[model samples]
Target: MPIPDGPTTYRELAELLRGRIEGGEYPPGEKLPNIEELMETYELARQTVRAAINQLASEGLVRTVTRKGTYVQARLGRRRVRRNHVVTRSRAGMYIFPAAAYPDEPWQTHGTPHRSMEAAPEVVAEQFGVEVGSEVLRRRRVMSPEEEPPFQIVDTWLSPQAVADAPQIAEKSTGPGGYLERLEEAGHGPISWSEITRTRMPSAEEASLLQIPGVLPVMEMILVGRSGRTEDALEVTIRVIPGDRVELVADLVRDASAQWPLRTAEPKE
Candidate 1:
């Protein structure tokens, strides 16, 4: 195919290349045009072409080898997360609830979870309605699909009251229903969850662990668990996942005013 037009900016160059990759012009595992060729075709400078390539790499669309050219990365399967009810039961135990969404797709915690009492970060403190640097119990783990690279880094922060009431939460395994169940047993029953999501670039550690490029933005989901008894939030969970690999599904309910009917005026004569 002929080069249609030259891109003036690096972003434009990236978009053009992205179109080609998504359009199947450059199939997965196929090497993209070399920097020199792309520079010539787009009438762009080497720096601009490199920047474009870097952007694509950050978005997980392509991979660059040490000596070989950049190749298109395989399209990853997207995982859907139902926003309303994320947890479900399984024979093994209670998990964060992906089974109902994709029962056949196997997922598990990637490594040993690290738990400690640490100073709360600003965001965590805000969610817990505590002062920054206040002590909180933190549990960090990497959750991934079986036989696949890590995709999510989860950090569960618990309030002091929660820990005091449910001492079992500090153990390596929280029996059966997981932390939520434990909280319920401690009279913090009938827990309600609310979540807020935002996107930001990953940290150095996150990028390394997730095997994603630094430029890629990740979706950070902050979920708060509150007890029916009190207004205070009992637990906070921060889930970070690659933006490209996950889809969030939520059900929207309409109010009575939105009900469909013949409420419109008649046509003018």
Candidate 2:
């Protein structure tokens, strides 16, 4: 095949291949033309073709495995995570909901929680209305979906007083009733909760831990569980979800009292 009438740069070659991928000429999971073939086809150098392939890898449109030729990555199907409790809570009300939002696909999440006590950060202090440096139980968990990449990273902070007797909250699994039930038993029953959503490029550590590609932003959900009709939050949990793999939906009701579309506390400065 003749090279297109243009400067045969790496970018131009990548664009040509990208067009093929988008045109379905090379279907998902199908191996692309090998480096030598691409170089000969595009009349480019080996290094030029390699750079073009790397471009595709960085864009997450393709994957290159060791000893395995590069293949077009399957377009990632996203799970719809809702803000409604109906979507979040199971019918049993005690057990945690499955991470796989799709009913057709059976997905299980494995969470490894690293528990520790850390002084409250300035933002946490403001969110919980506690003084900075207050002792809070911090549980950082990475929830990996079976047979795929990670689902989300969750960090939960509880007042020492709230989880003093609730040792189960620190474990990998809370077993029955989850942490909320345990907290309620400890006399800190959460009446209502709020969340703040934001998006940003993942940090180096976060990208490594989540096993995602470069510049892929992550959706952050900051949730605060509060006691009945009180501003004092009992627990603050933050979930980091891959923006590429998660979509959130929430039903809205027009109310003069409520300001935001989602039920979330004011962001701390």
Candidate maximizing lDDT = 1
lDDT of each: 0.82, 0.72
lDDT of 2 at 164: 58
Q: Best candidate per TM-score, number?
A: 1
Tens digit of per-residue lDDT, candidate 1, span 146-258: 77778789899998888888999988888887888898888987787877889998888887777676777898988888887775788999888887888878789978878
- TM-scores of the candidates in the order shown: 0.74, 0.63
RMSD of each: 5.0, 8.8
Off by over 4 Å in 2: 1-14, 20-59, 62-73, 80-92, 95-100, 103-105, 117-125, 129-136, 144-146, 165-168, 171-175, 250-269
Q: Please give the TM-score that candidate 2 achieves against the real structure.
A: 0.63
Prediction 2 global C-alpha lDDT: 0.72
